[model samples]
Target: MSSNALDQFLNENLEDLRSKGLYNEIDVVESANGPVIKIGGKELINLSSNNYLGLATDELLKEVAINAINEWGVGAGAVRTINGTLDIHTQLEKTLAKFKGTEAAIAYQSGFNCNMAAISAVMDKNDAILSDELNHASIIDGCRLSKAKIIRVNHSDMDDLRKKAKEAKESGLYNKIMVITDGVFSMDGDIANLPGIIEIAEEFDLITYVDDAHGSGVTGKGAGTVKHFGLADKVDFQIGTLSKAIGVVGGYVAGKKNLIDWLKVRSRPFLFSTAVTPADAVAATKAIEILMSSTELNDRLWENGNYLKNGLKQLGFNIGESETPITPCIIGEEKTTQLFSKRLYEEGVYAKSIVFPTVPQGTGRVRNMPTAAHTKEMLDQAISIYEKVGKEMGLI
Candidate 1:
């Protein structure tokens, strides 16, 4: 294709995004992403970060990262299949497996890449995958890359999943069948029906995959959704990220030893891409250790989440049914949702607007991530802002 043709296509797509009100304007976060952040020279109570445990700014994690840098230097020189598998990497994986109560674990450079690597590595063109309709974008892309026939079941609808699983298995149209879902749906903050899904998977003998990105740090007593329901051994593939609850950057899959071994050899990101930095690996390992030691952070996180959710509900905002630390104040229109977010920013809260394509068209929301570090004072201040902005916009 000519360069001008490609340019025209790109321009048209950009215009389409703008017309749909889906073009995101990037904000420059001037400080570390924490409970409070500086953006555009204005400080605001940040409710948009994934640092659920507040580990990103934790002195312990920072000290560990710095010490690792001093000891191991800055980067891993090559991919894990090459010379990049440092001792810290193995330690982190082992620590993760222990933390998650799995036999083994394999780490990827990022949570998104973990999906891209693990999904395609295990399931191929001759397979069929039954996925949740509300799964993360990474799960969708990973399913596509697998070249499997993707069947999206209704969000958390056990009957639909069971029906599809049976149909896929009976058809014999593929070599394998797998069911995948996000343990906690990020947008709605609702927990997946994993216990029901596990029962269906057992009935159909289907491979099981759960991306517990949101649930890892927030649910199941800090182990995750699998542990929450005592389905650890029942689920085949358990995926999580070090970035969210662990307060670092990286992703992992924990399961049987064979599965981790298989991913180490077959997952493209593990085999081909440069590995995570020594600092990141070491820091993530320490974070896991902290999580294993106590449920203090997790307890605080839930308390704050409940406080915020109750406050929003009492103020008459439509806070969705969330079972985790994630809370969403649903507004039905894209323009209104964006305006609401803008008003919150002006009033000094930093929750961002999530709109169509991310969620369904009419389910636009301002998702709030209440962390362990948020104090009662902070929660009160945020609720006050939410009420003021919501009332001003006639949303409450």
Candidate 2:
């Protein structure tokens, strides 16, 4: 028999979650997660993927991945410091540096691992990290791991950030001060005020770090938030993911040569964890090439976002204030949000409900992620379905 104490604890916790309607019921996708996805044998207008450029199903990437498997096999075989670090790994890093317009770049197993690796690689208990209030969870975990003095500045509040930065610099308490934020605030799709944040960092001599996971293939014509604001040379640490927009499986940090060199020698994950597969590395490199070569996909993405946003607003739904393709239809109550999402799925759209504590209490929403691959016809049908469901649920 299983341990009685452990089983009781787990069962009690699960029951509590279920009673509070907090337990997430995951859906099984029966096919590729593209603009359209099949789930439970039913197709949907899938609006819940981070595949912003729709590169996950791109023929070029698949072909390159298959060829890479043929040439380099399935895995890297060992930790990077041991027998890994294949040629594709090096080439991918070089291409990423060029793509981000940085002096150098380093790769990691995942975006979360990149943060865990980079933050602690540079900081320690004696240092401080001034982070945005709404920065991603990975950032929070990284800061905690470093044992850094974390000062959370008000979200997107320049005055608050400036004040905190000044106080932290004058405290004479920490060895180093770093200002970290997401390039794009994931939930609301609001672009970070990088120009303002960077100016404060410069004044306080704080290291500037931007995690551009969501913004990499969605902003700055697919270059990212720093390049979007034309401050590529000013930021100290630029972290991004190969998984989301790149449609592969890894993460990276691009910065000055010294930082990259230091991370290579110092980051625990890089030394201990095995490198990404050859297929992932090469496919990520090719995706970067596509983004660097043209703006067609980027343009299409923006166009789809605008179309959907306008359609939602016209139908009387409160989409909140978003400047990116990530959209949210606020449904207020947690149960209401879940019901709305369930009804929407039954009606053919595959948008997902995000409730507390992914968001704050009573601010639950059905998030929509429109991609470059969605056609006009698909969007129009989705909009009509939203109208029908919104009326049935009295959301509109």
Candidate 3:
């Protein structure tokens, strides 16, 4: 029998969430997660994927993955420290380092795991971390895992960061101080002020870490935000994921040779977890190579993003201040936002609603991710559906 107290706790919290309309019921996709997807036997113009460059279903990547599987079989067999460090894994790391213009790079099982492993490996109870208010959940968990003194700086507010850095440094109560932030804020699509942050980091002599997961393929002409700002060599740790724009699975940290070397021996995930499969490593490598070779897909992605934003803005939707392709159509109430998403699904669009805990309360939004694979026709149809639903729901 199940533990009664555990069961009761889950039941009460779940029912509370349901009653408050905050419970998110996930819809399973019946087809490939591409520009279009099928769910429940119905087709949808998918605007909810992180496949920003549309390489997830690229022909060349699929071919490379197949070849890799043929050569390396399925799994890596053991944890990286226990002889699971395959040649393909090494190749991928080298390619990532080159792509990010870093001296070396270390790959992890997943982006979330990368954060969990990398942060705790270097920081501990004696250190302090100054984090942006809206950093990703993984970053938050990673900081907490480090058992460091976490100081929250206001989102994109360099002034707050500077003040906190000053305090953290002047106190001299900590052995080390680190400033970490997302290169691109996923929710609002705003870019971080890396120049200002770097200046402050230099002033305070603090370590700098930038998680550019959403910015890798979508920013800097596909190089990333660090390269975009010409600060590639300045940031101590450059974290990214192969799962998003790269069109595969895994995460990585690109930095100086010494840093990567330290993470390889110290990061818990790298030491204890088996490496990504041969296919995943090769596919991710191929994706990065493609991005490095050409910016065609990146251009297409920006075009689509601008096009979608214009259409929604013309339709009188409250599209937030997103400097990147990740657009959020702000719809005030939580239940209303969910209803709007449901209406969108019914009308053949698969954009999802994001509410509190994911975002702040009463600032619910239908987040739209426009990828490179999307055609103008699909976007126009989605916009038309938005118009119909917005009119009927009196949202526009």
What's every prediction's RMSD, in angstroms?
Answer: 1.3, 0.8, 0.6
List candidate 3 stretches off by more than 4 Å.
Answer: none
Query: Which one is best on lDDT?
Result: 3
Model 2 alpha-carbon drift over 4 Å, by segment: none
Q: Evaluate all candidate structures by whole-model CA lDDT and list the values in order.
A: 0.92, 0.95, 0.96
Of the pair 1 and 3, which is ahead by TM-score? 3
Against the true structure, what is each candidate's TM-score?
A: 0.98, 0.99, 0.99
Tens-digit lDDT track for model 2 on 38-150?
99999999999999999999999999999999999999998888889999999999999999999999999999999999999999999999999899999999999999999
Tell me the lDDT of candidate 2: 0.95
* Cα error of candidate 3 at position 267, Å: 0.5
Residue 122 in candidate 3, Cα distance off native in Å: 0.8
Question: Against the true structure, whose TM-score is highest?
Answer: 3
For candidate 1, what is the lDDT?
Answer: 0.92
Look at candidate 2 and tell me the lDDT of residue 391: 99
